[model samples]
Target: MKRNYMYIVLAYGLFLGWLLSFPYNGPVLKHLVLIHQVPIASFSLVYTVVPAVFLIIYLLFFQIKEEYAKNIMNWSITACIVGTVILFTLPTYYWYPVLAVMGIGSVMYIIGWSYYYTMEIPIDEKMRIMALVIIIGNSIYYVINILHDQISIGFLLAVIIVPLIGAFRATSNIAVNNKIAVELEHEPLPVKLIFVICSFLFAVNITDGLTFHAIYPSFDQLFVEYFTFYGIMPYIITLVIIFFFGTKLSIMFPVFLGTSVLGLAYLSFGLMGKNWYSYFITETFLQMGWALLDLVLWTLFGLIASIYGRPLKICGYAFLANLLAVFAGGLLAVRILNKLDNYFIISAAFAIGIIFISFLIVPWLSEAIEKDLRNKLFKTNLQNKPIEEISPLSIPLPQREILTPREREIAELLIQGFTNKQIADLLHISENTIKTHTRKIYSKLDVANKRELLQLSFSSRMSKGRSS
Candidate 1:
């Protein structure tokens, strides 16, 4: 069963990789532009915007019930297959509609599969699984690029179909329960944390848009001329890094490293000028940096979804932010940056500024996110404990008046299993302050340890229940 699950994940990862790499590097979009006379910008806009719209709809109104998961997945995949066929065979007039269908289908399929996977998989294993999926998915695209000059329609069909079959067989018998959803209703959404994350993503992607044209003359130029050395090799190095260190490091490390490398890439373009050697150097760093950021983006969303138990909504909002940022960035790059005399230098400076800001801000962001997760876990642990384990005190808890208001707040968290450091993080105070508060809380409650404090708390609650 576990092996089958792994296969399903890998299959989806490969498709995801193809989605990420092919439109930019492979012949699909280029063929549409060269043969079918579809404008590159039009196709890009439809594909990007349509998915964003779908996510908006999903977030605002649509809810996927557990009973319909399989059907939604099946229909989404079918739509994608049909859209692919339309892209190949339909008239140029049908291109926009085809792209829209593909976009909507892709969003539905990705979110459906991802939500189910996150819900079913254990937390400890998720990071490693995500890393493997990313590596395989990306590696497959690069491998195909190396091996085939023109990917046949039949091969593309197989790529989509084979994965669909494997995923269906693996997940067909499984039933998802609504228990997590019910639990999620009780936990408040961490609005501040979500805002921070989305804002960071928006900033990162916008800069990517601003610098995109400066780095590559066109998408085809990168893969067509330097497919082997500059194109594939840098990504290979990135894959190796992700495979080895991705799961081992703190999540924020990648965010910092990726932004820094991106800064360097932009800096290279600014200093060295646009030539083959410079493009090679810039592209290498860009690929490595972008790959890391992409990995972090997906992983972070997955973590948020798992923690909140609202996978579709969380993932939907994240994708929406990403799409909008890319669109906004691309627009600015074309309209504003390209008109400037020193485009590369200005873009590089913007990127460098973003890196420095991230260095200053990412530590706080990491702590805020960590504090939320700790708080959630503390609540979950308390809820999941057996009733008998929460032994009631022979006497009631100490009177609330015994402690100051601040110490009362600290006592509540302490009884709820928050560590001193976690309390400090949550309350935005120093660890030393938390320790001082803890000592006062212990004195006021007449408790020696956390276990006794918890007992008194439970007893107080039970006593109130009996009296009322």
Candidate 2:
């Protein structure tokens, strides 16, 4: 894929975040509810339930046809436009059904584009792409929230239409590659691991729902008072952390830490009683924790989809888990907690309790799952076999003197299946430097590619073992 094509993928990410931040989950929902005098409970239910049902249906039954994916995507965009228009102009009675149709369109839109992404992009590239997407997408969301007062219906329509145009152009330019499918057949889906992680996400996000309600009792407060400092800054910081350290750190570390931070944030809210100073401190931590967890959840799903080569299935189920948890927590907060006294205290206790449970379980799950994925991805099963049995004398090994120490190190990493980018990151060098060394290593070893280099290395090692 062209580098420019990867940049274009950002349009889809921006669109997703923009939609969620505005018309779906954020300010627009509040705007509509307040203006049309729709009950919050009924509005929340229709918004959450309709899309969630569509996501679940897609997860269970829908499959995107690769050939017709572009058409599906274009049509889904049209549905979204029509749905938005109807939503803005129509009577309250017509809202629920239109929302349902829009929800289906959203699901189709996501699944269709995601299928192309998973098929065309390699896993490593997917990680970089997703990280960039989250960073820029959320930044755009924050900017919109900041300027919400200035935002007109025309502005909203422009946001949708601009990205839609870009997305259509990008999808047209995407080059199809089926090489990943062959690898997918060899690797088994880590079904149990995925389920457990999804369950953890569901549980954690329920606390988010509770705390979200506890922190901002009114949506107007979210817009006018809180989101400016407490919301945008911490989230931006979190995105930066994910962008820089995400690949280097284990997923469990951030998750555990995020949950702990959130627990403490809520605990502070209960103990400190929403004083300005206290609110600032707690809400900053709260946004950081929430942003961290949300980004990690999507990153985890993207990683799974990359490995499994079924983007729709993996991402759809992930979306379902996350959406349901948020919905359930939101519903619980609205219906039950609003009636209860000391709701902040109740929410804090629940969040802190989940932290304890996560602390106990996340380590074991992370270790086991990471180990399995690493072993499978790196072909570490060869370690269990005899050297002679696994290594064939298909390629001649070059003399050790032909390579410099740096070249040797680079070659070793290549044989171990590290990409140039990974090797550069590991060695604290520029990728261009790594590329230079890789070229020298390839030339010295008389190999055109990593596969040949691997064959040569294996044969050399096996020969040495026999001689010794």
Give per-residue lDDT, candidate 2, residue 305. Answer: 65
Instruction: Report, for every candidate in turn, its global Cα lDDT versus the true structure.
Output: 0.70, 0.69
Best by lDDT: 1
lDDT of 2 by residue, 1-468 (tens): 476447446647656665655556666656666778877556556666888887776667776545576677778777777777777678888877777777667766766677666666554555445656667767776766666555776576565455555655665665555554444532566788789778988988887677666566533343446655456678678767776766676666778878888888878877887566666778777878877777666667766666555666676777678779988888789788878887877877887888888888788777865776675566534433443343212233558678887777777766766667667766779999998988888887788988888888888988977889
* Index of the highest-TM-score prediction: 1
Model 1, position 207, has a per-residue lDDT of 68
lDDT of 1 by residue, 237-332 (tens): 775666676557888888898899988988988888856777778888888887778777777777777677667667677778888988898898
Worst 10 residues of 1 by lDDT: 387-396
